[model samples]
Target: MTIDRPRSALMAVLLAALPAGCTPVATVGPSRPPLAVRGSTATVEIAPVLLAARDHFPDGAEVRNGGIPNLVGAAPVEGLGGGGAADVATHAETQALRYSVAHPDIRIILTVTEGLYRIVARRSAGIASVADLKGKRIAAIPTTSSGYFLARMLASQGLGLDDVEVVRVSPIETMAKELADRKVDAVAIWEPHADNALRALGTDAIELSGTSIYRERFNLNSTAAALADPARRARIVRFVRAVLAATAAIERDPRPAQALVAATGGFTADEVGRSWPHLAFPATLPGDLVDLLVDEEAWLAAQEKRPARERGELAKLIDSSVLEEALAPPR
Candidate 1:
């Protein structure tokens, strides 16, 4: 898929550990399929990648609406699939576990952005701190990163997920409304939905974030076959470089990027503005990505009732050379 450009909170995540990286462009080859890409149009996390595809891309790639699931067909279409048209895709690391094992060709080349999730609780629900979430109804999508974040957050407070009722929220766009209507007392999710919940609650809102526990690594992914081909690799590198440049533009002034996201994701300007700080456009591979994956595998493994993989196997899923070439010194 063609890439797109791609958060904030009360505690604010420490993404300084996620470094700024660069890359240069290459000309696309004349080929079949037009080199389409798949990613989530509804997610603000992928705005930069979307922008890159629209504004950059020498040969221009199709920015299909899907995610990592689109890159590989191992998982169901629930996540927005990559299929045959998806030469590239963007998704969080958790999704990688499900499809990466079955499809060994998949690899994460760059972390386009980071999702600093937060728990937006209704202060009226007798919750004002992370510790107060016990026995409360918390909305988080199960079998995904959001649920993992909920578990991690609760563990920090000496509580387990069993201590509270985990309410399932669908359409994800409804997460804010679910909490605001008191159907769920809290929501641990990605922005701008998390920020939407906070604003909905207003005086009743209590936001608790900032944890070393977990920050979703939303990355750019491609198959080994695509990268191994000279023509396709050249096109991929150019797309990656475009993504990095788009991120730089985002970090400088998010207004234009916000407008794009608001229009694409159907988010209001205030929602985009409020949630902007929650995201970090590192665009570089985070040093601890594999470590994060290893730590997270067990949770996903348990969810799917499968054995977790070793660190080495997970490491193979990330290929840094593309970003390195992109970040290489200009000759």
Candidate 2:
């Protein structure tokens, strides 16, 4: 039976109200949305999830373009199959609170930080350290991991975005060139692009040291209703397992993962190799996940012009059961 528009709205309302671990009755066939993972082809971050879908996942999974916003917004928003949102999506933790405000049920299930995120700056710009970034123009994608990273890095050295000219460059992949051409002094960005910046500037390019300052907690997210649905949840778990397996494979022998990313033609083999090491695959959820969220919430809330939610409130966004089960030993 086709679900009428009225029933569909009602179902959405009902699903939104359900607890994070609860779901309506199981339904199959065309009415149910096909299980799909969503992410961006633009960044090197999505490679592990891509590998999982391509090799390890039992279901025929394919990654579509988009991120947390598309995942949290009801379908018709992102055009995921069967008029539903992506069951699982990949993005940085920075995206969580912004989207979760409307869809409080969004849960971060896995830490997808296959590597470290960074800031590429020009040595000619007198940028020897993170502190020197003050008063210089830096390009960053707003409300993204890269943006949040800029904030954290600056704050670490008693600087804020106010202290620097934060430039938002179009076709963010061009950020590297921007720095090399001196259009911007520095850029806080994810891999491949960060690698591109280094390549664009070569000896003139300096990656500011901030291993202790910040790292992108790129993650896999799903809705409460999806997690609550047994079948959907199982598929999601399987995909997480696949992601972990893929991470292990990438860790053991990155050439395969590098080839996979190269196969997409987004980045050259060298770009992937240089940037790939910057990422460390810790398949498990980080213990600092909630701590990071609580700290980042203030910045996100201020940026959105809203009051930050309580710490406990932010804590609800993580659902570790999926990771736990994914790592659990066979019975």
Q: What TM-score do all the candidates reach, one by one?
A: 0.87, 0.85
lDDT of 1 by residue, 119-164 (tens): 8999889987888988899999877789889988988889988899
lDDT of 2 by residue, 1-331 (tens): 0111123444455445434533322233554554566766556777787667666765656466666766766543222223336788877788777789888999999998744767889999998998899899999987677788889899988888899998999777689888888899998887878878888998998887567877778889998888999999888998899998999988887766666555442455677788777887788889888888988899999999999999899888999999988888845
How does model 1 fare in lDDT? Answer: 0.78
Q: For model 2, what is the alpha-carbon lDDT of residue 306?
A: 90
- Show how many residue pairs clash in every candidate, following the order shown: 25, 6
How accurate locally, in lDDT, is each candidate? 0.78, 0.75
Instruction: Pull out the clashing pairs in model 2.
Output: 114-279, 114-280, 115-279, 115-280, 116-278, 116-279
The superposed Cα distance between candidate 1 and the true structure at residue 220, in angstroms, equals 0.4
Error of 2 at 270 (Å): 0.9
